[model samples]
Target: MNGMLPWAISFALIAVALAMIFAAIRLLRGPAAEDRVLALDTLYVNGMILVLTLGIQFGSRFYFDIALLIALFGFVGSAAMAKFLLRGEVIEP
Candidate 1:
């Protein structure tokens, strides 16, 4: 079971990477700003998943912290971008 952990994480990371590539293509080819933003959000989610897989592969808690930070930043950035796209500004005052 212990030996299988790394292999499982490796497979998950590979899957996430592939998904990220597809998301990148979507980001590049999206016809609308909102579509591009949605693709970018998906990319962020894949990145967080990759980080988690890395943490599992390496048996490190540090990567978990980094993943948490990435998730937090991703959420905040996506929200700001969406707000800016909808209202033309992130903040009114």
Candidate 2:
């Protein structure tokens, strides 16, 4: 019903999308494994942000759930990758 909120959301969505794109480029072109992992983590965070913003715009619980899942998996994945980079193993036997 208001014009300003829609514009604000649109701007946020575009900004998040651009962040995701930059993260993706970093993931692809990073010189170090840690840099790539950081980029990947950034991508996930940006993705989660985009999802939440979209949820706010659309008033959808589904988007929130998806964003939560992304956050969980992204954290787990970053931890695993960090472990692997440090010790060459995600799960030590």
Candidate 3:
């Protein structure tokens, strides 16, 4: 089982990369603003997952930290974009 671990991790990383590619295509070609926003949100989530998977594969604490930062910034960015879409501005006076 141990011998299969690296292959599994490689497969997972490739799958996530493919997913990210699809998400990027959607982000670029979305028909509407909402669709694009959703795609962007998905892209960030996949990025975080990819980073976490790398951390697990490599046994690196640094990748985990980077993944955490990705999640945090992604959430905040999504929230701000949503607010801007709804109100035309992210911050309220």
For residues 1-93, what per-residue lDDT tens digits would candidate 2 score against the true structure?
Answer: 669999999999999999999999999999999999999999999999999999999998999889989999999999999999999988998
Ordered by lDDT, highest first, the candidates read 2, 1, 3
lDDT of 1 by residue, 3-79 (tens): 88677777898899999999999999999999999999999999999998888778899999999999999999999
The top-ranked prediction according to lDDT is 2
Overlapping backbone residue pairs in candidate 3 total 0
RMSD for each of the candidates: 1.4, 0.9, 1.2
Of the two candidates 1 and 2, the one with more favorable TM-score, higher being better, is 2
The 10 consecutive residues of candidate 2 with the worst lDDT sum are 1-10
Off by over 4 Å in 1: none
In angstroms, the error of model 1 at 17 is 0.4
Q: Model 2, which residues run further than 4 Å from truth?
A: none
> Against the unseen true structure, what C-alpha lDDT does each candidate score?
0.93, 0.95, 0.92
- On the 0 to 100 scale, the lDDT of residue 29 in model 1 is 100
TM-score of 3: 0.93
Q: What is the TM-score of each candidate against the true structure?
A: 0.92, 0.95, 0.93
